[model samples]
Target: MAKIEMKNPIAELDGDEMTRVLWAVIKEKLLEPFVDLKTEYYDLGLKSRDDSDDKITYAAAEAIKRLHVGVKCATITSNEARVKEYNLKQLTRSPNGIIREELDGTVFRAPIFVNNIQCCVTSWKKPIVLGRHAYGDVYKNCEIKVPGAGKAELVFTAEDGTEIRKTIQMMKGPGILQGIHNMDKSIESFARCCFNYALDQKISVWLGTKDTISKTYDGNFKTIFQKIFDEEFKAKFDAAGIEYFYTLIDDCVARIMKHEGGILWACKNYDGDVMSDMIASACGSLAMMTSVLVSPDGNFEYEASHGTVQKHYYRYLKGEKTSTNPVATIFAWTGALAKRGELDGTPELVDFAKKLEKATLDVIEEGTMTGDLARLANPPAKQVLDSWAFIDAIAAKLK
Candidate 1:
């Protein structure tokens, strides 16, 4: 069969560890044989980032801006241990963070639900997509560790030589102080992105923030979302039979547990960061979660919500067979391809993407899965395949 032709290239951001190993296999067995794949490839491996002084990361982000679609493998976010292990010159920042900042995108994470895999939350019959604002707040903060007792103040200086200051705290001994901020532009971008995505998915948008306490900070977020929805999205939302719901973060959490899924929960930086993980685990393993970074302008970068399988990679190095799930990674490619197909008027490509995803879920439904999923499968898989074998299984089922 002739390969499906692609009109535009996808920005492929390659990574490290076991996912990278599966990346090559997936392309060879599943993608290359069926599609004339064109990708603006960027090796985002740790060494590559260190070698290029992280220029490759920025370059990849730029290419995605031009191409408008990216599919990324899980990469390492350098830490103290990783710094020493990789022997890097400096602690490299998270590639996802860099791309999100460059594109000013909101990260949306949703689970890949399969019939055989039981969700810990038994009431969740549908998927709940978590839209996380990926900028500002505690993720980017200034902190000071006070050495001794002193008065701490929050000061603001205007360009017109006006200064306003207020006491933050009076410490009796050593303490800590932190200052965090969010830009109005970024917050507005986040609101628009969530609303746009909700409209695209035809799902309700539920925004949660602690505006009752942080009146100035969280209140701004609530205000911006309400303003945008009322002015820009309310008509569209009502026309589509969808609703925009806002409540305190605590109430949101309580409601989420009791409510059936199928809504997009828009959260602040810290809340989203924590809630996404909780939702992922409650629905299934992190390996079953698919993530996409959607910019307000409609550009997208898809990826797995999990990290590089470093432990599995180490075992593989020791000649051990490891059963690491590749479902999310495969879905990442399919998602980007589907979007590429939709934009480029290639329905066959979109069909192939749909088939690929169905094949993956079909494999799981057949009681053949990786270790993580096998444990949760209603009837445990008789035999769990390793990462490569699992990909081969899905390939055989791709039809």
Candidate 2:
């Protein structure tokens, strides 16, 4: 049989380390036989990034913007150590964070549920997708430390020639003051991204904020989300059989811990920053989580939530046996391909993604897993295969 052709090819973002190794295998084992895939590859590896002065990340993101689908690998976030190790010219930052900021998207991380792994929140039968707002709150902040007695105030002057100033506090002794800002445009972008994602997925959306406490900072989020929901999505929610709810931050966190799944949690930058890590731990291993950047315009970028697996990469370099789990990386491809299929009206590739995802999960359910799960085993499951072999197990089933 001739290989199937997909018109909606992905703008592939290749990265470093173990994921770099797995990228090739995923194409060969999962994608090649299924689809005659076309990829606009950007070498976002450490060396290439240094050589390109990280222009490649922006170019890659722009490519995604143009093409509407991206499948990215986990790249090395060059630290001082990495700089010495790679023996490079200039220090490079993390490609993932840069691409995300440039694309102006929200990251939605969903755990890859497999029967073999035990979820800390056991009730999460379905996926609980978190559309984390990545723009403001603690990430961008103005700070001042009072050496002497001083007043901390927030001043807002209206366009109608009315100046409003509020002095929140007067420092008794040496203290700290802060001013954080989020542009209306940024907040609107976040709202659109979450609304677009929830509507696209047909999943309920929930927004949480500590509006009761920090009325100004958190209230901005609440007001924007409400405005967007009411103006754009109310009737659509009714039509689509999905719901939207707003709750206090504390309540949201508590509910998230207790509730099962099938709800989308839209959080502010800081909340997402904290909760995502918590959720990652709760779901078991970071390796099991998959992060996807959903642009406001509905472009997609999928990658492993975990890092480059630096330790495993070094061992693999020494030609040692390494069972670096490739499930998340595999899902990244499946997601991009599936999104491509959906956009292009190609049911074959869409079905291929679903089946490939199921195959990976099925392999896990059968207890044929890599080192991470093997270590996290409840009764310590005996059978353990290395990385390539485990991927082969998934591929054998995919075939």
The TM-scores of all predictions, comma-separated, are: 0.96, 0.86
Task: List runs of model 1 lying over 4 Å from the truth.
Answer: none
lDDT of 2: 0.83
* Deviation in Å, model 1, residue 393 alpha carbon: 0.5
Clashes of each: 0, 0
| lDDT of candidate 2 at residue 27, scale 0 to 100 | 87
Pairs that collide, model 1: none
Q: Write the per-residue lDDT of candidate 1 for residues 23-85, one digit (tens) a residue.
A: 898999999989999999999999899889999999999999999999999999999898899
N/CA/C clash count, model 1 = 0
User: In lDDT terms, which candidate is top?
Assistant: 1
Model 1 TM: 0.96
